[model samples]
Target: MKKLLVITCFLLAGMGFANAQQTSPVWPGCEDADDVKKCFNQKLSKHVQQNYVYPKNEAGEYVRGKVTISFQIDENGKVVVNSVEGAKPKVNQAAKEMILKIPEMEPGTLNGEPDARNFTVPFNF
Candidate 1:
Protein backbone atom coordinates (compact mmCIF):
# COMPACT_ATOMS: atom_id res chain seq x y z
CA MET A 1 0.00 0.00 0.00
CA LYS A 2 2.85 2.41 0.75
CA LYS A 3 4.45 1.66 -2.63
CA LEU A 4 1.15 2.33 -4.42
CA LEU A 5 0.81 5.72 -2.67
CA VAL A 6 4.38 6.71 -3.64
CA ILE A 7 3.81 5.74 -7.28
CA THR A 8 0.61 7.77 -7.45
CA CYS A 9 2.35 10.79 -6.01
CA PHE A 10 5.13 10.52 -8.55
CA LEU A 11 2.66 10.21 -11.40
CA LEU A 12 0.78 13.31 -10.31
CA ALA A 13 3.99 15.30 -10.08
CA GLY A 14 4.93 14.18 -13.58
CA MET A 15 1.55 15.23 -14.88
CA GLY A 16 2.04 18.71 -13.50
CA PHE A 17 5.36 19.06 -15.28
CA ALA A 18 3.88 17.77 -18.53
CA ASN A 19 1.15 20.40 -18.45
CA ALA A 20 3.52 23.35 -18.50
CA GLN A 21 2.55 25.70 -21.34
CA GLN A 22 4.93 26.89 -24.03
CA THR A 23 3.94 29.17 -26.90
CA SER A 24 5.45 29.69 -30.34
CA PRO A 25 6.64 33.09 -31.57
CA VAL A 26 3.72 35.09 -32.94
CA TRP A 27 3.86 36.38 -36.49
CA PRO A 28 3.12 40.05 -37.15
CA GLY A 29 -0.57 39.52 -37.90
CA CYS A 30 -1.14 36.62 -35.55
CA GLU A 31 -1.75 38.67 -32.44
CA ASP A 32 -5.41 37.63 -32.36
CA ALA A 33 -5.01 34.17 -33.83
CA ASP A 34 -6.99 31.30 -32.36
CA ASP A 35 -4.08 28.91 -33.01
CA VAL A 36 -0.84 30.84 -32.86
CA LYS A 37 1.34 27.99 -34.02
CA LYS A 38 -0.73 27.35 -37.13
CA CYS A 39 -0.81 31.02 -37.93
CA PHE A 40 2.94 31.30 -37.55
CA ASN A 41 3.47 28.38 -39.93
CA GLN A 42 1.20 29.91 -42.54
CA LYS A 43 2.96 33.23 -42.32
CA LEU A 44 6.37 31.62 -42.57
CA SER A 45 5.34 29.67 -45.65
CA LYS A 46 3.98 32.78 -47.28
CA HIS A 47 7.13 34.73 -46.54
CA VAL A 48 9.27 32.00 -48.03
CA GLN A 49 7.21 31.80 -51.17
CA GLN A 50 7.29 35.53 -51.65
CA ASN A 51 11.01 36.01 -50.95
CA TYR A 52 12.55 32.91 -52.48
CA VAL A 53 14.92 33.57 -55.40
CA TYR A 54 16.36 30.98 -57.65
CA PRO A 55 20.11 30.87 -58.13
CA LYS A 56 21.70 30.35 -61.49
CA ASN A 57 25.04 28.83 -62.38
CA GLU A 58 27.62 30.52 -64.60
CA ALA A 59 26.01 28.92 -67.64
CA GLY A 60 22.68 30.59 -66.75
CA GLU A 61 21.13 27.26 -65.70
CA TYR A 62 18.98 27.22 -62.62
CA VAL A 63 20.70 25.70 -59.64
CA ARG A 64 18.89 22.73 -58.13
CA GLY A 65 19.47 21.80 -54.52
CA LYS A 66 17.90 21.61 -51.10
CA VAL A 67 18.97 23.67 -48.12
CA THR A 68 18.29 23.12 -44.44
CA ILE A 69 18.21 26.33 -42.47
CA SER A 70 18.27 26.73 -38.73
CA PHE A 71 17.17 29.94 -37.10
CA GLN A 72 15.89 31.37 -33.89
CA ILE A 73 13.39 34.00 -32.86
CA ASP A 74 15.18 35.65 -29.98
CA GLU A 75 13.68 36.85 -26.73
CA ASN A 76 13.73 40.35 -28.22
CA GLY A 77 11.61 39.15 -31.16
CA LYS A 78 14.38 39.36 -33.74
CA VAL A 79 15.09 36.81 -36.41
CA VAL A 80 18.60 35.31 -36.34
CA VAL A 81 19.88 32.78 -38.79
CA ASN A 82 21.96 30.17 -37.01
CA SER A 83 23.14 28.04 -39.89
CA VAL A 84 22.42 26.94 -43.44
CA GLU A 85 23.48 23.72 -45.11
CA GLY A 86 23.15 22.62 -48.70
CA ALA A 87 25.02 20.86 -51.50
CA LYS A 88 25.78 24.15 -53.22
CA PRO A 89 26.93 27.37 -51.64
CA LYS A 90 24.57 29.44 -53.77
CA VAL A 91 21.58 27.49 -52.54
CA ASN A 92 22.66 27.95 -48.95
CA GLN A 93 23.14 31.67 -49.46
CA ALA A 94 19.73 32.00 -51.08
CA ALA A 95 18.07 30.19 -48.21
CA LYS A 96 19.90 32.34 -45.69
CA GLU A 97 18.78 35.52 -47.43
CA MET A 98 15.17 34.40 -47.43
CA ILE A 99 15.20 33.56 -43.73
CA LEU A 100 16.83 36.89 -42.90
CA LYS A 101 13.89 38.69 -44.43
CA ILE A 102 11.50 37.45 -41.75
CA PRO A 103 10.09 40.37 -39.81
CA GLU A 104 10.38 40.85 -36.08
CA MET A 105 7.32 40.25 -33.98
CA GLU A 106 6.21 39.27 -30.49
CA PRO A 107 8.50 36.76 -28.90
CA GLY A 108 7.34 33.35 -27.77
CA THR A 109 6.89 32.45 -24.12
CA LEU A 110 7.78 29.58 -21.87
CA ASN A 111 5.70 29.49 -18.73
CA GLY A 112 4.48 32.99 -19.65
CA GLU A 113 7.90 34.62 -19.88
CA PRO A 114 9.62 35.71 -23.08
CA ASP A 115 11.76 32.93 -24.50
CA ALA A 116 13.73 32.26 -27.65
CA ARG A 117 12.36 29.70 -30.11
CA ASN A 118 14.51 27.70 -32.51
CA PHE A 119 13.30 26.48 -35.89
CA THR A 120 14.75 24.27 -38.61
CA VAL A 121 13.20 24.25 -42.06
CA PRO A 122 14.11 22.96 -45.49
CA PHE A 123 14.06 24.87 -48.76
CA ASN A 124 14.25 23.45 -52.25
CA PHE A 125 15.35 25.27 -55.36
Candidate 2:
Protein backbone atom coordinates (compact mmCIF):
# COMPACT_ATOMS: atom_id res chain seq x y z
CA MET A 1 0.00 0.00 0.00
CA LYS A 2 2.68 2.47 0.99
CA LYS A 3 4.89 1.64 -1.90
CA LEU A 4 2.03 2.21 -4.25
CA LEU A 5 1.52 5.71 -2.92
CA VAL A 6 5.19 6.56 -3.26
CA ILE A 7 5.21 5.26 -6.78
CA THR A 8 2.10 7.20 -7.62
CA CYS A 9 3.60 10.37 -6.22
CA PHE A 10 6.76 9.88 -8.21
CA LEU A 11 4.85 9.26 -11.41
CA LEU A 12 2.74 12.34 -10.85
CA ALA A 13 5.85 14.39 -10.21
CA GLY A 14 7.48 13.14 -13.36
CA MET A 15 4.40 13.86 -15.45
CA GLY A 16 4.10 17.32 -13.96
CA PHE A 17 7.72 18.00 -14.77
CA ALA A 18 7.19 16.84 -18.33
CA ASN A 19 4.19 19.09 -18.71
CA ALA A 20 6.18 22.05 -17.44
CA GLN A 21 8.87 21.50 -20.02
CA GLN A 22 8.75 22.94 -23.48
CA THR A 23 6.39 21.08 -25.78
CA SER A 24 8.83 20.76 -28.60
CA PRO A 25 7.23 19.45 -31.77
CA VAL A 26 9.30 16.55 -32.88
CA TRP A 27 8.04 13.58 -34.86
CA PRO A 28 7.18 11.21 -32.02
CA GLY A 29 8.32 7.95 -33.54
CA CYS A 30 9.13 9.07 -37.05
CA GLU A 31 10.91 11.80 -38.92
CA ASP A 32 9.82 15.32 -38.07
CA ALA A 33 8.80 15.67 -41.70
CA ASP A 34 6.26 12.93 -41.07
CA ASP A 35 3.25 12.87 -38.78
CA VAL A 36 4.63 12.80 -35.24
CA LYS A 37 1.53 11.73 -33.36
CA LYS A 38 0.60 9.07 -35.84
CA CYS A 39 3.96 7.38 -35.60
CA PHE A 40 4.06 7.57 -31.85
CA ASN A 41 0.64 6.06 -31.44
CA GLN A 42 1.33 3.27 -33.87
CA LYS A 43 4.60 2.39 -32.23
CA LEU A 44 3.08 2.51 -28.79
CA SER A 45 0.22 0.28 -29.82
CA LYS A 46 2.57 -2.23 -31.31
CA HIS A 47 4.62 -2.27 -28.11
CA VAL A 48 1.61 -2.91 -25.93
CA GLN A 49 0.42 -5.71 -28.12
CA GLN A 50 3.80 -7.40 -28.11
CA ASN A 51 4.74 -7.18 -24.44
CA TYR A 52 1.86 -6.37 -22.13
CA VAL A 53 0.59 -9.11 -19.80
CA TYR A 54 -2.04 -9.16 -17.13
CA PRO A 55 -0.60 -8.50 -13.65
CA LYS A 56 -0.35 -11.17 -11.00
CA ASN A 57 0.53 -10.79 -7.35
CA GLU A 58 2.93 -12.86 -5.27
CA ALA A 59 0.07 -14.81 -3.78
CA GLY A 60 -0.69 -16.08 -7.23
CA GLU A 61 -3.73 -13.95 -7.36
CA TYR A 62 -4.74 -11.74 -10.20
CA VAL A 63 -3.65 -8.21 -9.40
CA ARG A 64 -5.74 -5.34 -10.50
CA GLY A 65 -4.02 -1.99 -10.55
CA LYS A 66 -2.97 0.84 -12.75
CA VAL A 67 0.65 1.19 -13.68
CA THR A 68 2.30 4.41 -14.57
CA ILE A 69 5.06 3.77 -17.05
CA SER A 70 7.72 6.12 -18.37
CA PHE A 71 9.93 5.72 -21.35
CA GLN A 72 12.09 7.72 -23.72
CA ILE A 73 12.35 7.40 -27.46
CA ASP A 74 15.92 8.31 -28.24
CA GLU A 75 17.22 10.00 -31.33
CA ASN A 76 18.29 6.59 -32.54
CA GLY A 77 14.79 5.26 -31.93
CA LYS A 78 15.69 3.02 -29.02
CA VAL A 79 13.34 2.59 -26.12
CA VAL A 80 14.67 3.60 -22.70
CA VAL A 81 12.56 2.19 -19.90
CA ASN A 82 12.59 4.49 -16.93
CA SER A 83 10.07 3.69 -14.20
CA VAL A 84 6.79 2.01 -13.35
CA GLU A 85 4.38 2.78 -10.55
CA GLY A 86 2.78 -0.25 -8.93
CA ALA A 87 1.85 -1.72 -5.58
CA LYS A 88 4.79 -4.09 -5.25
CA PRO A 89 8.38 -4.19 -6.39
CA LYS A 90 7.73 -7.30 -8.44
CA VAL A 91 4.74 -5.71 -10.11
CA ASN A 92 6.64 -2.57 -10.88
CA GLN A 93 9.60 -4.55 -12.15
CA ALA A 94 7.40 -6.67 -14.34
CA ALA A 95 5.79 -3.62 -15.84
CA LYS A 96 9.19 -2.10 -16.49
CA GLU A 97 10.43 -5.20 -18.25
CA MET A 98 7.29 -5.49 -20.29
CA ILE A 99 7.58 -1.90 -21.37
CA LEU A 100 11.21 -2.43 -22.25
CA LYS A 101 10.20 -4.98 -24.85
CA ILE A 102 8.82 -2.12 -26.90
CA PRO A 103 10.22 -2.25 -30.39
CA GLU A 104 12.46 0.53 -31.61
CA MET A 105 10.71 3.25 -33.53
CA GLU A 106 11.94 5.15 -36.53
CA PRO A 107 13.04 7.93 -34.15
CA GLY A 108 11.65 11.42 -33.91
CA THR A 109 12.71 14.24 -36.17
CA LEU A 110 13.24 17.85 -35.23
CA ASN A 111 14.03 19.10 -38.70
CA GLY A 112 13.82 16.11 -40.96
CA GLU A 113 16.18 14.49 -38.44
CA PRO A 114 16.13 12.40 -35.31
CA ASP A 115 15.32 13.94 -31.94
CA ALA A 116 14.89 12.56 -28.41
CA ARG A 117 11.49 12.61 -26.78
CA ASN A 118 10.02 11.30 -23.51
CA PHE A 119 6.73 9.44 -23.26
CA THR A 120 4.58 8.78 -20.24
CA VAL A 121 1.99 6.04 -20.54
CA PRO A 122 -0.36 4.30 -18.15
CA PHE A 123 -1.03 0.58 -18.19
CA ASN A 124 -3.91 -0.90 -16.26
CA PHE A 125 -4.29 -4.56 -15.45
Candidate 3:
Protein backbone atom coordinates (compact mmCIF):
# COMPACT_ATOMS: atom_id res chain seq x y z
CA MET A 1 0.00 0.00 0.00
CA LYS A 2 1.00 3.59 -0.45
CA LYS A 3 1.08 4.13 3.30
CA LEU A 4 3.46 1.25 3.84
CA LEU A 5 5.83 2.58 1.27
CA VAL A 6 5.69 6.01 2.79
CA ILE A 7 6.41 4.57 6.20
CA THR A 8 9.28 2.48 4.94
CA CYS A 9 10.80 5.48 3.29
CA PHE A 10 10.46 7.51 6.44
CA LEU A 11 11.94 4.78 8.56
CA LEU A 12 14.87 4.33 6.26
CA ALA A 13 15.51 8.02 6.25
CA GLY A 14 15.10 8.02 9.97
CA MET A 15 17.56 5.19 10.32
CA GLY A 16 20.17 7.06 8.37
CA PHE A 17 19.53 10.28 10.23
CA ALA A 18 19.43 8.43 13.53
CA ASN A 19 22.83 6.88 13.01
CA ALA A 20 24.45 10.19 12.22
CA GLN A 21 22.54 12.24 14.79
CA GLN A 22 21.94 9.87 17.68
CA THR A 23 24.08 10.45 20.74
CA SER A 24 22.33 7.92 22.97
CA PRO A 25 21.18 4.50 21.88
CA VAL A 26 17.46 4.14 21.46
CA TRP A 27 15.61 1.16 22.89
CA PRO A 28 14.99 -1.87 20.73
CA GLY A 29 11.74 -3.55 19.63
CA CYS A 30 10.02 -0.33 18.62
CA GLU A 31 9.41 1.29 15.29
CA ASP A 32 8.00 4.60 16.55
CA ALA A 33 7.51 6.79 19.59
CA ASP A 34 3.95 5.68 20.18
CA ASP A 35 5.00 2.04 20.11
CA VAL A 36 7.69 2.71 22.65
CA LYS A 37 5.31 4.57 24.93
CA LYS A 38 2.75 1.79 24.57
CA CYS A 39 5.39 -0.64 25.71
CA PHE A 40 5.57 1.33 28.97
CA ASN A 41 2.19 2.87 29.77
CA GLN A 42 -0.70 0.91 28.31
CA LYS A 43 0.94 -2.48 28.20
CA LEU A 44 2.08 -2.50 31.79
CA SER A 45 -0.72 -0.66 33.56
CA LYS A 46 -2.06 -3.79 35.09
CA HIS A 47 1.38 -5.07 35.88
CA VAL A 48 2.18 -2.00 37.95
CA GLN A 49 -0.88 -2.42 40.10
CA GLN A 50 -0.22 -6.11 40.65
CA ASN A 51 3.56 -6.23 40.96
CA TYR A 52 4.74 -2.85 42.27
CA VAL A 53 3.95 -2.48 45.93
CA TYR A 54 5.22 1.10 45.91
CA PRO A 55 2.77 3.86 46.67
CA LYS A 56 2.27 6.73 44.31
CA ASN A 57 3.80 10.11 45.16
CA GLU A 58 0.30 11.13 46.03
CA ALA A 59 0.35 8.88 49.05
CA GLY A 60 2.39 10.60 51.74
CA GLU A 61 4.08 7.66 53.32
CA TYR A 62 7.67 7.09 54.40
CA VAL A 63 9.41 4.58 52.20
CA ARG A 64 12.97 4.77 50.91
CA GLY A 65 12.88 3.41 47.40
CA LYS A 66 13.61 5.32 44.22
CA VAL A 67 12.96 4.37 40.64
CA THR A 68 14.70 6.34 37.94
CA ILE A 69 12.41 6.00 34.95
CA SER A 70 14.64 6.61 31.97
CA PHE A 71 13.49 6.68 28.38
CA GLN A 72 14.40 7.95 24.95
CA ILE A 73 12.82 10.67 22.87
CA ASP A 74 13.11 9.47 19.34
CA GLU A 75 13.23 11.50 16.15
CA ASN A 76 9.48 11.33 15.70
CA GLY A 77 9.07 12.96 19.10
CA LYS A 78 8.15 9.73 20.86
CA VAL A 79 9.06 9.11 24.47
CA VAL A 80 10.72 5.73 24.80
CA VAL A 81 12.05 4.00 27.88
CA ASN A 82 15.76 3.39 27.81
CA SER A 83 15.81 1.77 31.23
CA VAL A 84 14.48 1.95 34.78
CA GLU A 85 17.19 2.10 37.40
CA GLY A 86 16.27 1.67 41.03
CA ALA A 87 18.05 1.69 44.33
CA LYS A 88 16.86 -1.74 45.33
CA PRO A 89 16.32 -4.96 43.47
CA LYS A 90 12.65 -4.96 44.27
CA VAL A 91 12.29 -1.38 43.15
CA ASN A 92 14.27 -1.93 39.98
CA GLN A 93 12.35 -5.08 39.13
CA ALA A 94 9.03 -3.43 39.72
CA ALA A 95 10.13 -0.40 37.75
CA LYS A 96 11.36 -2.54 34.89
CA GLU A 97 7.83 -3.80 34.38
CA MET A 98 6.32 -0.38 34.84
CA ILE A 99 8.89 1.12 32.51
CA LEU A 100 7.68 -0.97 29.62
CA LYS A 101 4.15 0.27 30.18
CA ILE A 102 4.86 3.94 29.51
CA PRO A 103 3.68 5.41 26.22
CA GLU A 104 6.11 7.25 23.95
CA MET A 105 5.78 10.93 23.35
CA GLU A 106 6.57 12.66 20.10
CA PRO A 107 10.26 11.83 19.76
CA GLY A 108 12.80 14.62 20.28
CA THR A 109 15.08 16.04 17.66
CA LEU A 110 18.16 18.14 17.19
CA ASN A 111 18.21 21.23 14.99
CA GLY A 112 14.48 20.92 14.34
CA GLU A 113 14.70 17.29 13.38
CA PRO A 114 13.65 14.25 15.34
CA ASP A 115 16.51 12.56 17.18
CA ALA A 116 16.77 9.79 19.73
CA ARG A 117 17.23 11.28 23.18
CA ASN A 118 16.87 9.99 26.72
CA PHE A 119 14.71 11.13 29.64
CA THR A 120 14.70 10.34 33.34
CA VAL A 121 11.75 9.85 35.69
CA PRO A 122 11.86 9.41 39.42
CA PHE A 123 9.24 7.64 41.52
CA ASN A 124 9.29 7.24 45.28
CA PHE A 125 7.21 5.26 47.71
Candidate 4:
Protein backbone atom coordinates (compact mmCIF):
# COMPACT_ATOMS: atom_id res chain seq x y z
CA MET A 1 0.00 0.00 0.00
CA LYS A 2 2.83 2.42 0.87
CA LYS A 3 4.60 1.69 -2.43
CA LEU A 4 1.43 2.29 -4.41
CA LEU A 5 0.90 5.59 -2.63
CA VAL A 6 4.42 6.70 -3.42
CA ILE A 7 4.05 5.78 -7.09
CA THR A 8 0.80 7.65 -7.35
CA CYS A 9 2.41 10.73 -5.83
CA PHE A 10 5.25 10.55 -8.30
CA LEU A 11 2.86 10.28 -11.22
CA LEU A 12 0.87 13.25 -10.00
CA ALA A 13 4.01 15.32 -9.61
CA GLY A 14 5.14 14.51 -13.17
CA MET A 15 1.77 15.56 -14.54
CA GLY A 16 1.98 18.86 -12.64
CA PHE A 17 5.44 19.58 -14.01
CA ALA A 18 4.36 18.83 -17.56
CA ASN A 19 1.50 21.28 -17.31
CA ALA A 20 3.67 23.98 -15.73
CA GLN A 21 5.84 24.54 -18.76
CA GLN A 22 5.20 27.88 -20.47
CA THR A 23 5.47 28.72 -24.13
CA SER A 24 8.66 30.61 -24.83
CA PRO A 25 8.82 34.04 -26.39
CA VAL A 26 9.51 34.14 -30.10
CA TRP A 27 12.53 36.12 -31.22
CA PRO A 28 12.11 38.70 -33.95
CA GLY A 29 13.73 36.75 -36.76
CA CYS A 30 12.74 33.36 -35.45
CA GLU A 31 9.01 33.74 -35.78
CA ASP A 32 8.67 31.25 -38.60
CA ALA A 33 11.21 28.80 -37.25
CA ASP A 34 10.29 25.44 -35.73
CA ASP A 35 12.22 25.91 -32.47
CA VAL A 36 11.61 29.42 -31.21
CA LYS A 37 13.21 28.98 -27.81
CA LYS A 38 16.51 27.64 -29.05
CA CYS A 39 16.69 30.21 -31.82
CA PHE A 40 15.89 33.02 -29.43
CA ASN A 41 18.67 31.98 -27.05
CA GLN A 42 21.21 31.64 -29.83
CA LYS A 43 20.28 35.01 -31.29
CA LEU A 44 20.40 36.67 -27.88
CA SER A 45 23.92 35.47 -27.19
CA LYS A 46 25.08 36.54 -30.60
CA HIS A 47 23.42 39.93 -30.24
CA VAL A 48 25.08 40.57 -26.89
CA GLN A 49 28.50 39.56 -28.15
CA GLN A 50 28.17 41.63 -31.27
CA ASN A 51 26.93 44.76 -29.55
CA TYR A 52 29.06 44.61 -26.40
CA VAL A 53 31.04 47.78 -25.74
CA TYR A 54 33.51 47.80 -22.88
CA PRO A 55 33.15 50.69 -20.49
CA LYS A 56 36.15 52.92 -19.77
CA ASN A 57 36.75 54.73 -16.52
CA GLU A 58 37.75 58.37 -16.09
CA ALA A 59 41.42 57.45 -16.37
CA GLY A 60 40.67 55.71 -19.71
CA GLU A 61 41.24 52.27 -18.19
CA TYR A 62 38.97 49.41 -19.25
CA VAL A 63 36.34 48.53 -16.68
CA ARG A 64 36.87 44.90 -15.77
CA GLY A 65 33.93 43.13 -14.16
CA LYS A 66 30.75 41.20 -14.82
CA VAL A 67 27.07 41.96 -14.56
CA THR A 68 23.94 39.84 -14.78
CA ILE A 69 21.25 41.75 -16.65
CA SER A 70 17.69 40.83 -15.90
CA PHE A 71 14.82 41.76 -18.16
CA GLN A 72 11.30 40.82 -19.13
CA ILE A 73 9.42 40.46 -22.37
CA ASP A 74 6.13 42.13 -21.68
CA GLU A 75 2.75 41.29 -23.16
CA ASN A 76 3.46 43.60 -26.06
CA GLY A 77 6.75 41.87 -26.76
CA LYS A 78 8.97 44.76 -25.74
CA VAL A 79 12.16 44.26 -23.80
CA VAL A 80 12.06 45.91 -20.41
CA VAL A 81 15.31 45.89 -18.48
CA ASN A 82 14.64 45.22 -14.81
CA SER A 83 18.04 45.22 -13.06
CA VAL A 84 21.77 44.87 -13.43
CA GLU A 85 23.75 43.18 -10.69
CA GLY A 86 27.38 43.03 -9.57
CA ALA A 87 29.17 45.65 -11.63
CA LYS A 88 30.26 49.28 -11.74
CA PRO A 89 27.75 51.94 -12.76
CA LYS A 90 29.13 52.29 -16.26
CA VAL A 91 29.29 48.55 -16.73
CA ASN A 92 25.72 48.12 -15.57
CA GLN A 93 24.50 50.86 -17.85
CA ALA A 94 26.21 49.34 -20.83
CA ALA A 95 24.71 45.95 -20.13
CA LYS A 96 21.24 47.42 -19.87
CA GLU A 97 21.63 49.29 -23.13
CA MET A 98 22.80 46.19 -24.92
CA ILE A 99 19.86 44.13 -23.72
CA LEU A 100 17.41 46.86 -24.62
CA LYS A 101 18.61 46.74 -28.17
CA ILE A 102 17.05 43.35 -28.67
CA PRO A 103 14.32 43.63 -31.27
CA GLU A 104 10.73 43.25 -30.24
CA MET A 105 9.69 39.63 -29.84
CA GLU A 106 6.46 37.67 -29.70
CA PRO A 107 5.47 37.66 -26.06
CA GLY A 108 5.57 34.42 -24.12
CA THR A 109 2.37 32.60 -23.33
CA LEU A 110 0.98 30.77 -20.34
CA ASN A 111 -2.02 28.55 -20.90
CA GLY A 112 -2.52 30.22 -24.27
CA GLU A 113 -2.58 33.69 -22.75
CA PRO A 114 0.13 36.25 -23.31
CA ASP A 115 2.33 36.64 -20.26
CA ALA A 116 5.44 38.42 -19.09
CA ARG A 117 8.51 36.25 -18.68
CA ASN A 118 11.85 37.13 -17.12
CA PHE A 119 15.25 36.39 -18.59
CA THR A 120 18.83 36.95 -17.50
CA VAL A 121 22.01 37.49 -19.47
CA PRO A 122 25.52 37.74 -18.08
CA PHE A 123 28.15 40.07 -19.45
CA ASN A 124 31.85 39.74 -18.58
CA PHE A 125 34.09 42.62 -19.41
lDDT of 3 by residue, 1-125 (tens): 99999999999998887676423322444445555656545434454565566533336753458778776656764555677776676667667666555454445445556667666767774
lDDT (10s digit) by residue, model 4, range 6-33: 9999999999878975888899789788
Local accuracy of candidate 2 as per-residue lDDT tens digits, 1-125: 99999999999999886665333333344555365677657766776777766567678886666778888978787879877777766667777888777666666556456777888888775
Evaluated against the true structure, the overall lDDT of model 2 is 0.70
TM-score of model 4 vs. true structure: 0.79
Error of 1 at 32 (Å): 1.2
lDDT by residue (1-125, candidate 1, tens digit) is 99999999999999987987888899999999999999999999999889988889999998879889999999999999999998999889988898999999899988899999999998777
Clashing pairs in 4: none
lDDT measured at residue 123 in model 2 versus the true structure, 0 to 100: 72
**Candidate ordering by lDDT (highest first):** 1, 4, 2, 3
Q: State every prediction's TM-score relative to the real structure.
A: 0.84, 0.61, 0.41, 0.79
User: By the lDDT metric, which is better: model 1 or model 4?
Assistant: 1
**Best to worst by TM-score, what's the order?**
1, 4, 2, 3
Off by over 4 Å in 1: 1-16
Taken over the whole model, the C-alpha lDDT of each candidate is: 0.92, 0.70, 0.59, 0.87
lDDT of 1: 0.92
As for lDDT, the candidate ahead, 1 or 2, is 1
